[model samples]
Target: MRPVGLALIALAALIPLFWFAPLAASRDPVALFSQYLGTAALIVMGINQFLATRVPGLELVFGPLDRIYVLHKWLGIIAMVGLGLHDIIDADMDGLRGGPLADAAEDIGEVSLYGLLILVLASVITFIPYHLWKWSHRLIGVFFFMGAFHYFFIEKPFANADPLGLYVSAFCILGLVSYVWMSVLRPLAPRGHAYKVASVRHINGLTEVLLEPRGRGLKHVAGQFAFLSVMGGGLTEEHPFTLSAAPRDDRSLRFTIKDLGDYTSRLYRELKVGMEATVSGPYGNFSMPSGRDPQVWIAAGVGITPFLAFAQTLKHRESGPIKLYYCVRERGDIPYVADLQHLAEETGKLELMIVNSLEGVRLTPERIVEDLKGDLRNAHVFFCGPAPLRKTLKNSLVLKGLRASRFHFEEFQMRTGIGLGRLAVWLWDRGIYAIEKRRAEKTQPAE
Candidate 1:
């Protein structure tokens, strides 16, 4: 899908360039022609922005889509440079440089110098990987408006001067309108629900926060997460955090976070009581089984957060026969240990196994399989942790002849960074393919 989107945008940009090639016999004509191409490029950018936000299920291609996003930024810079050259050749620089202060300002406004400046600034700010960049990028919303204003008000004159220009100008306006609708208005509309923090506690070198919906709502299932936006900060900057509390009728949500990066660290240090948060979620399908089938949840370090939710849900719902193999560096690294213990005591169907790597206690898949040699036959296994740990556990389980369908894992690393638009598009394409394949397989007659 990303390749298709990129190809479409590239075609839009190139079409104007190709149309102008025949007019290169006249320098003035060529300069004017390039301005039209620049306008087309802006329209392409608007289309890219629109598709990125509206599309869903993009995580699968996030790794490659990030490269496309870098290309998108550079393409914008190239368009701005081309427009600058076009203005230099077509418009009178002498007039722009020598006019009165008010005249110069008016000329500047006519050419979208302010819009270009804002675009450049927004692009630079986005390069910063910190949470500040997350907050600052909301200002890019202003750039879309500015670009539309520049297109409709300033370029419209050139557009009206010629039939070809008018056609391009009308299309640009339409694209800009679509971009604004999708990127700004739609996101701000009430779509998802909200949650309030029930409690904030420090455990196992992580901050555990419990949240519940502000009103009547369905509880989240185990292994699902919510996208949380802390108010007082910009609303556009939301991060996904796994739920650490079980699903229940009580209106409490929980998140266990370690101080790893800028956002989580600040969430631990700076979040206060009564801080309003918007939650868009309960996404993911990693849940324990409910029948007589045995299940195992393997977690490492703060990755135990989701497992805690599963355990709690199991305890409260009496959905049982579950085992947890939680590995941590030290006793202090075990998040919600006391809570897990309490839940285990309440639900005799739950077994808690703790492995401390820092205390010279190493756990290999072979050793784990050996410990539960007979128990491995009828169990589903779920794992959430660092890549290396997950890989080891997965290999161990596979060696024990566990079917692939019985293994569940959550990959949250793909959700990091600023290029969600590209990610969303990529995910949408993959999700469509997966759905189609599933439907085909389901409908096929058995051999």
Candidate 2:
């Protein structure tokens, strides 16, 4: 029922064609396979560039922008690994013609491979600062350009007229075009609706930015999100945030951003009213079901943003009985509590339930089913939360009477790594913290 990324599937399907052409040039399978890998890696790199462009209608193809990013990350890793193998395998054809251009291309190829390997390492090691990581990521296009040059000039088994050469050349062009569009052209001509900050509110460690359109505004479904770039207070990077408020007559937008990272913390401290902002999108399909079916909404922490938008819109739209569960660590952590409570009372079709985990209360599937009066046969369950909680609830609910399809969450966006990388980061953080504490203790005056 979910999108498996049609573009990725098509790439996989086309890979065998790379193997077919290079086989004629060499009887040794190792050399031929390496050539196939080189070509395939180029194609993957091209598509990877395309995916990073943040072009409209990509969510339709890739499911969600977050998922598209996830795919982009993996594809890049695969391309790097594939190219690494291709280089190491020594796929050079015997008695190939050489020249100054070929010699330069060979040297460039080596540099590009090592450069890509370093960039790939930077990507995998997630602890790097975002700005640095982003800057390093931009240099990938340079390497891609160099790699393209190397591909064309270097002595290889196939001629330029060959099918393999032509096919790989097409992808190289695609990558170059995408790179130019994103890095060179897109910045000069910005995308998205221009707006000025109408108001800024800090509540419960979250920054709520209200923006009013300077010209034409954005139109969006209640549950969709937008990428916002605040042009003032030293903030220029675009970050995705869900529109917490429903679309209004004035066409103003509201983004409830948590101060979780460096950019957000800076924005929270520095962003002011009347500062200009640009917002692009209305992306994602994570909206309410169209049909008037009973629904159970589960939200944890800041995951309540979309649900808040949904509740605000419920006055106009007709829907079946909806039981909304707001899960939080403590009472103070709940955002828009009074608004949600008012909405529940104002709309007789809605019910609000608060689950406080800090008070030793857990929102288990059993509790949800019990609250629903043991009927999940007809109710759709929509959730936004931590990945582990989602997994636990989904698996437990499916074990019960709830159908697997009925339990829906932004699975790709909420994915957790397989623990190893996360564990290493956790250990690294603890070690740094302990070292800092000991240093501070030594510097302190003793009685």
Candidate 3:
């Protein structure tokens, strides 16, 4: 189906629960609707998170389904708002005051208050932009677990009162269990080995940290990433950093991270040698296929880090037939240029092309296409950069009659949750559904 068709279908499925107005006004509609919507939102969030980490083919769905993902995030915010509204505007507030909710709130007292506080904290933290979200998102997970416990014990009375609420509660419990299992419990399972940072090297305005895994070493392929978290620090903050070192190096693993923002900028200043860090994986499919065909790697700025891993892998194997086009704003912006140059010198099969767009030397798609006219037909192009640059290159490749399968890329941004509360607020603010009306022309029916 088309992207719009899929979105319309999803909207159709979700809208009816809200649009049905009053389903027996004697019942508390707000509470009832909020329970359903919030549960569904959590389920969807869990599914999306799981798919994002585990599924490779999700890119096909997510690529065209960006609008659905946006809607999902807004819907999550809306669900949170809906829950808040349900609490505030509950018709049974008087009954609840003297009953289960109130008694639970009073008996547990400070623990209940802390759980509510944590929920509020999680809501506030999620509102930040994607980049900052990475550093702060782990705390949100803490809030999630706290909230789950609160819901399990304190709020069980309300959920048990109604059949619909019972079902919602059950589903929510399962969803929370699944989320925690996939994200936290599974990753922390004993692997019987550990890695320590041997040396942290600062190169080309980026930090390249070498990791030495004790015992059986980490088995990884080129162009994959590992989720690394420093010991003593909470597991919630484990960030995925691409491996810049060759996979063949069993003795150690190296990660080159640019000082882009929060986590990275502090790596050199705060992280120390001999610090034991846990590495979770070597995930991603941005490497060249095994067959013997020419390959081109297009990298912009810090995107060169992954290519370093690929180059290192090729170097260790003494394999060639791969060309790299490294583009940057200036000559100084290029990371590991000398190393890449040395690799090119050592391996005659490797070709290096550096394009400086800022030095009045514009690197247009047309120019790149012309440069690789012969090789472009067979080579699979792997590009990593900012969205706009990727789009330009993608469009250029499409115009040149290149297949979509020939291109590969990765996004560094995190997908934030969308709730129904945010959607309502957005619609209210923007009047998004205001469709243009066309005047009906007078028509005569044929006899």
Listed per candidate, the RMSD to the true structure in angstroms reads: 14.6, 6.8, 9.7
lDDT of 1: 0.63
My TM-score estimates for the predictions, one after another, are: 0.57, 0.88, 0.65
Candidate 3 Cα lDDT to native? 0.60
Badly placed stretches (over 4 Å) of model 3 are 1-39, 46-170, 178-193, 231-237, 249-251, 315-321, 331-334, 374-377, 414-447
Which portions of model 2 miss their true places by more than 4 Å? 1-4, 7-9, 12-22, 331-333, 411-419, 422-447
lDDT of each: 0.63, 0.83, 0.60
Better of 1 and 3 by lDDT: 1
| lDDT by residue (tens digit), candidate 3, 1-447 | 136544643553355355334443544665555444444444443343343343345434544233334443444454455444534443232223243454454344334334434543453454555455444544434544444443444432254446544544554555466567656786667632378878988877788888888767677777777677776433235677788867764757888888866667667577788888777655665666776666778888888878887876665564437768888876554678889988888867678888787776656777666667655677678887776788888888877866777887765433533354576698876653443221222243446
How do these models rank on lDDT, best leading? 2, 1, 3
The lowest-lDDT stretch of 10 consecutive residues in candidate 1 is 91-100
Q: Highest TM-score, which number?
A: 2
Higher-TM-score candidate of 1 and 3 = 3
> How close to the true structure is residue 441 of candidate 3, measured as C-alpha lDDT?
23
List of clashing residue pairs for candidate 1 = 57-427, 58-427, 210-253, 210-254, 211-252, 211-253, 211-254, 212-251, 212-253
Candidate 1 Cα deviation (angstroms), residue 119: 13
